[model samples]
Target: MISDTLIPDTSMTETNTDKDHIKATMKDAILKAAEKVFSDYGFEGASFRAISELCGAKRALILYHFKSKDALWKAVAEDVKTRFLTQFSAYYHEAELKTDLQKSRQLNVAFLKAARDVPEYGRIILHEGLTPNERIKWMSQELKPELVTMPDLQDPFLIEASLSGLIRHMQAGALLYLGSMGPLIAMDTEDADTLLSDASIEQFADYFQAITLARMDQLKQLEEMQKEQVEE
Candidate 1:
């Protein structure tokens, strides 16, 4: 018999524990709709009406449920936080994060695989996380103690911002590029599809990993130079 604790668990019990299942369902719908809308149009471009129209729920109901647009965005952000924890945290926990380069490469691959279907997640991340919004702040607080096993980041917050930006841009660009030109590019291709395919995705991971390792090396060199100057 397999032990339950050792098994990788992705199950959510549908019990009426904290929030009513109905309310949870409604909130999830709103948040999903908001994700699509916000992804297509940024935070400033998305509105309660747009989300409500997509959800097929009354706009007033959206307000009654979440209070306002910013509140809805906050809820969206909270949902994003939970999603990241549930989706990618396990892999990070599973990996050996001895160095930033290794961790960045591992995390990039993990996040790309986890997010292939949920491309809207990339959009949601880009919308608020381009400048370290509250969601990212919460993520920093949550992920650091767990996955960031490194002693000190190259300015932890700045590192987080850079990583997030790189992931968001690559994810969005890959989806857009492949969706438009994937067929044409892969017509006489050697192996497989362009961006959406697993091979292409892995290629992206490799590219981004190289970029991240280079950046880390540059930061280390800068730190060493500063130390030499201080000693002089």
Candidate 2:
């Protein structure tokens, strides 16, 4: 009988104040604080009190939204997924057909452009992927079912693995771009093409393109061999 009423018994005069449409100010405040703190210190060095102080919230309020430091870290990981993975996955998937080494130059450039445009993306990836953490593992397993399972539908795990490695290599250079070559690259500028035109930025992108193309050729050979076996 208790299970029959899933809806709250609020009267008609009572307004529903806790709708999902309501912006979670508390959560956002805490998340923003956590991002700054975590970015500066990494997860191990970042403290709840530091985040709470940065957020201008009591420690209890921070804990109330996040439950525990681990939960907060998980939230940050999810934040990275929402911020970076959603867009990068789409762009990378769309850029797949532009596999020519020349055309992929633009994709490589675009990757750098996106990192600049979305600065948090660089920090989040470095922290979550490059660094080791259970929170990273948990969020990765929870969030990336589509990316991981995609190899099943695509039937080319090798291609995807090679691509993953290439992307990681590009992202590894992102911080350096921000620190040293940022002004010349004009990373703060909005133009993608201009920033990519710098001659010094050539090596990683060129190497990635070459390696990826070679991997593709290998995959094609494997496919042809499988077809021959089937015909035989």
Candidate 3:
């Protein structure tokens, strides 16, 4: 038989643990829903009610978990950055490649895959790029310290902005421009959804890879010519 003091302590501990689990679960749900809503609608357009509804939780619960929409958006951005870095790390460890160029290609492929897997990330990033809000500034500042350690992301800003822009344009261009640019790619307005399809993304990735390789080769040749001129 346990002492009376021991019983209350054990019960309190169990209750606290359960509350923590519930809070974490609710936070995860809120973040998942927030990602979709924030991606579809920019920060100003996103609503706490809509996020709560999507997550099937009360607005009060969302408020309890995240204080405000600004806090929620920041949390979402941090979560995305964490996941992106994790995916990059995993891919870097698994890829056994020969040259820096080859590794760069692999890194791009990994980035594309990660973007496709979490397309919201691209949308959020593009929206931030356009809006230039405090949240965006905060995220950029937070990532700056770690940028030097990421060799694969040598030009992190350019690489990320390029990839995110490509993904966002492919996914949301129709809404922005009434599909005016679709004809250029032989794609009709009705086929906009296909842009996010796995087959289409793979094809696009291949095309991008070829173009990048060609550009790299051209740069190498130009450098060789410059070296020859210097020697002469």
- What TM-score does candidate 2 reach? 0.57
Q: Cα lDDT of all candidates, in order?
A: 0.61, 0.58, 0.60
lDDT of 1 by residue, 1-232 (tens): 1122322222565555534655666666777787678766767778777876666667887888888887877677566556754666665557777765566666666666555655555566555556745566754554333332322345553375455565455545654544335546667574344456667767887987676556667777878999999999
Best by lDDT: 1
The backbone clash count of each candidate, in order, is 0, 0, 0
**Candidate 3 per-residue lDDT over residues 41-88, each given as its tens digit:** 879889988886677767887888889888898888778767766765
| Candidate 2 stretches greater than 4 Å from native | 1-23, 89-110, 128-133, 139-204, 214-232
- The C-alpha TM-scores of every prediction are 0.57, 0.57, 0.64
Ranking by lDDT: 1, 3, 2
- Candidate 1 residue spans exceeding 4 A from truth: 1-21, 93-101, 128-193, 212-232
lDDT string, candidate 2, 50-73, tens digits: 886765667786787788887887
Tell me the lDDT of candidate 1. 0.61
lDDT of 3 at 131: 72
The per-residue C-alpha lDDT of model 3 at residue 105 equals: 53
* Model 2 steric clash pairs: none
List candidate 3 segments past 4 Å from native: 1-14, 91-93, 142-202, 221-232
